[model samples]
Target: MDEDTPRLLADTNPLPETIDARLAQQLTFLIEIDRLKTVLRQSPLAAADRRENDAEHSWHLGLMVAILAEYADENVDIGHTIELVLIHDLVEIYAGDTPLYDAGKGLDQREREAAAAGTLFGLLPADQAARFRALWDEFEARQTPEARFAKAVDRLQPLLLNWMARGGTWRTPGVTADDIRARKAVIGDASAALWAAGQELIDEGERRGWSRPGSASIT
Candidate 1:
């Protein structure tokens, strides 16, 4: 290791010399994730004036999986689903948060996130790096039931926040309810019940002028 490595470790939390390579790698990965706390998201907190961060969003998704698993359309492995949720946004630490309505940013999101995933997940040991990357890939593919439900929860989260905040993101110029519905209709794929609830919020948002009108459908 470089001379700077030891000082870097000491500057943060110092670990015992007995720590193995795997443990050191794991710890490094954990420390690296602290940067996620600084990455801001578009969804604003209902009670706070500032926007939420990537780490907060991931934690909220994990909690949402725990509390709302029963609402999933198919029976899902809660732990796996939670893992997917927690791992999904780690890429944002490097790639930055991409707003749903920003078509320009959305265009290169997949490429940007893929590169970020490699950089972030590579901090772990080989086995763990593969495992975490697999989880991230599964969440991105949205093929498995756990991944689908995790994605549904992911999409539902900001919708709930926007509704609770009374047009949080919807209030943005040119961001209409129809545009949101068109984008968010995927929520129904994993949980019809949750989508039903989300649908109500979107409709009410439009009626209340929380979001402007557009041409589209939800589910």
Candidate 2:
């Protein structure tokens, strides 16, 4: 073994055997998640000058959940919903951000993200890792009310940002309004009010000529 390797391991020290390892595990996981700050997404910030990273995306989703929970079609546990949003993209810290418009790569993407989830969440103790993994899975599955709402906001955030930026990513060739609408359809199922807000943004984008006239029909 390298001389510094043992020293680095010693610094971690695994806490004390008698100490509750939960705190240490949780802290380790928290520190690992900070890597997300460096994982940039394809979507640009509202300013449209630069892209937003996964950490900012998760933070925005958390705030959206707080502000929009009341509009969910079904009652949701707000805390659980927040947890779902915050950790949903932690896998991206390893898998990297796949653009929403990317097609023909879903299977590979899922496999990559699953492996990422395993390694990243494994930083926590077994029990906490399982819980975190389950939350991420639930967000992907979108079966629970909380998960559905979280997914809706996840889709909504970028759409809103794109709208505010006058077609941040939408302006890119091959990104159609229909593509956006189809991707955002879940928001309609989750919250009519939020869906209405999203549609209004889309309409404004159309009116301002931010989106190509025929782009909506491309898909």
C-alpha TM-scores of all predictions? 0.91, 0.86
lDDT of 2 by residue, 23-78 (tens): 77676667667778999988879765898999999999999999989999999999
Alpha-carbon lDDT of model 1:
0.87
Expressed as tens digits, the lDDT of each residue in 42-104 for candidate 1 is 999977998999989999999999999999989999999999999989888778899988877
What's the count of clashing pairs in each model shown? 0, 0
User: Whose lDDT is greatest here?
Assistant: 1
Candidate 2 deviant stretches above 4 angstroms: 1-22, 104-107, 215-219
Error of model 2, residue 184, in angstroms: 1.1
Q: Candidate 1: deviation at residue 30, Å?
A: 0.2
- The numbered model that scores best in TM-score is 1
Instruction: List the lowest-lDDT window of 10 residues for candidate 2.
Output: 1-10
Provide the overall lDDT of each model, using Cα atoms, as 2-decimal numbers.
0.87, 0.82
